[model samples]
Target: MEEILGILTQLGLTEYESKAYISLVSLINAKADEISKNSGVPRSKIYPVLENLEKKDLIKIKQGRPLEYHVIAPEISLKNYEENIIHNIHILQQKLTRIYEEKLPHVNTPIITVEGLDKILKKEYEIIKQTKKILYLRIGFILPSEIENIKKALNKLINNGIKIRILAVEECEIDGKVVSIRDIFEDMDVEIKYKQLPSAQLIIRDYKEMFLVFAENSGMSISNSNMVGLFNTYSVIISNYLSAFNKQWSKL
Candidate 1:
């Protein structure tokens, strides 16, 4: 059947090889000419297809006046193929991991300047999504429109077993219902503290990377304001900011 042939091809058999195998499975021990007639493969191609199948251990060749091809049991043949694939994947993982570890110490400091509120928020969302161990955030304020997205990102991080620590200036309310950002993370077991609004906005992840945004006019709506920020993994700068954040957190 076409479907069986398709499945056989997906399992690493060439189309001609799959057809020839299927034909030989039905015929048991058949000469190349008979296999070519049943499988619809050209007689010239059937010999090469059988040879390849024999090489792959999917078929056995019988010595006789005219050579005959017989299909190997699918269970044995397919299981061997699957095991080979998994073994190769494991070997690839080991080699790639070694290369990754070798280059990690030589990695350079990367400082990227992202402009515009939208661009900064986009980068923030990306960084938050990649959070692993810990996320430290100082929120002066977030736009009402962006709150939902930010909450979603935080929730995803929490689900991934990343611990979160947040410091904020004040609470926000929508439609007369108080929206406590901390309350959203209540069951997630994150630490939330309140403080007088800091002059700059900060987001640090895993104590290794940071983003700092400074606005020209503090009173202007954050969504519409022009903001400048650096997103970087410069270790010394990150360490200093982490220390400052810890100092500020201690006060709260």
Candidate 2:
């Protein structure tokens, strides 16, 4: 019962509404007073909750001296809810993507410098989330501690139908230990190529935005090294960087 209520809330129902709906489903057709008693919802709130459930198409109302509500079959209710949710998601994604693209050229500064490994990783995740179609990444090294989190995000993007291509070193020293970059990410549903690269990392998103991170020392541990990153959405800059990335990709 608790699990069903939890699932209902996750699908965008309030606690009161979920409880009332569940109670009504059990009763099949019940008056507001009966629903309030069975659902533990206060009598004062039960009518409003039921009205909301009716508005959501989850329940039907029978008009009379005392209003009675009937639950929509679970299969039909859930299918309708799922379709509505998916339609809303696509509408929201399209709206947000348009706004993001429109604002790119108007950014006051094309490039912003970021400092620290944690901040760089956070920026990387943020940029990846904004990618609409494809993500291209090349990294000479990754911090040993954060690789798992990166892989998880990449896997999610792949599952969302984002095409991802990664270029990484075969092995690199991180925190004084040799780490195999290929073994960590190659198993995921992404195209990856391994090569020895300079002490830098690059990410291109949808061929429109670019992020580059540089290490102060190639020999130093990446986690402890001084890291600086530059992010921009300038089309010309992205184009130049992509050309270089494709050149390296061909060699691998």
User: lDDT scores for all predictions?
Assistant: 0.77, 0.87
C-alpha TM-score for every candidate: 0.54, 0.61
User: What C-alpha lDDT does candidate 1 achieve relative to the native structure?
Assistant: 0.77
Tens-digit per-residue lDDT, 92-193, candidate 1: 978996785456335656788989878988988877876668999987655566677988888888778789988886654333344455555455567888
In angstroms, give how far residue 191 of model 1 lies from its true place. 0.8
What TM-score would you give candidate 2 relative to the actual structure?
Answer: 0.61
For model 1, how big is the CA root-mean-square deviation?
7.1
